[model samples]
Target: MGNSKLYKGSLSTIILKLLSEADKMYGYEITQKVKELTKGELQITEGALYPALHKLEAEGVLEVEVARVDNRLRKYYKLTEKGKEETVSKLKELQDYIANMQVLFNPKFGLES
Candidate 1:
């Protein structure tokens, strides 16, 4: 529970990357996928997840489709063309950031020269 807070920052990036891999996905599906992929290291809360989804949708980076499933309305999100391009750049940016963080966190392993 305590360690969960540490993952808060990466949630958006994670969600974006996941949506990039395919066409679209639903809220519960995203949560389940993240849990399965991370082996429980990250559990996205509804509060955090929905807000990010809404923000992305509002930003026009994502397209939303509402459909009836099991007699209930389900909203699915898919990346727009812009989102596809953005995903590539965002992933590269995130990769570099993580690499730098690794070097900073493990000074002994980083190049001294």
Candidate 2:
């Protein structure tokens, strides 16, 4: 993948959250969405993105639907019930991680050392 550790760690969670919001999205759409959302700050390559999608699909948290669009088959991914639950959990974890980082980096958050 060769992406940053932070992005690699949260990639699946990001995909889950996006799918949870969009109902379904194809691979390229997900990439573009991320770029748009991030104001071009982040760009996800296929090499990194597909593996995460495949892993999530294999985990039974995501389902794929293949449809013919303009005479070509496109695979759209959506969150399953388990995926929905996982999304919530992942978001919570990310939030907690951010909070912990804040506490660690900011001297005066909620505790005194």
> Lowest summed lDDT over 10 consecutive residues: which window, candidate 2?
1-10
State the displacement of the C-alpha of residue 113, model 2, in Å, after optimal TM-score superposition. Answer: 15
Candidate 2 C-alpha lDDT tens digits along 37-99: 888888889999999999999999999999999999999999999999999999999999988
Stretches of candidate 1 exceeding 4 Å from the true structure: 1-5
Give one digit per residue, the lDDT tens place, for model 1 in 6-111: 5777676788899988788999999989988878877787888999889888887789999999999999999998878877887898889877888899986468
Scored by lDDT, model 2 comes in at: 0.92
Top candidate by lDDT: 2
lDDT of each: 0.84, 0.92
Over 4 Å off, model 2? 111-113
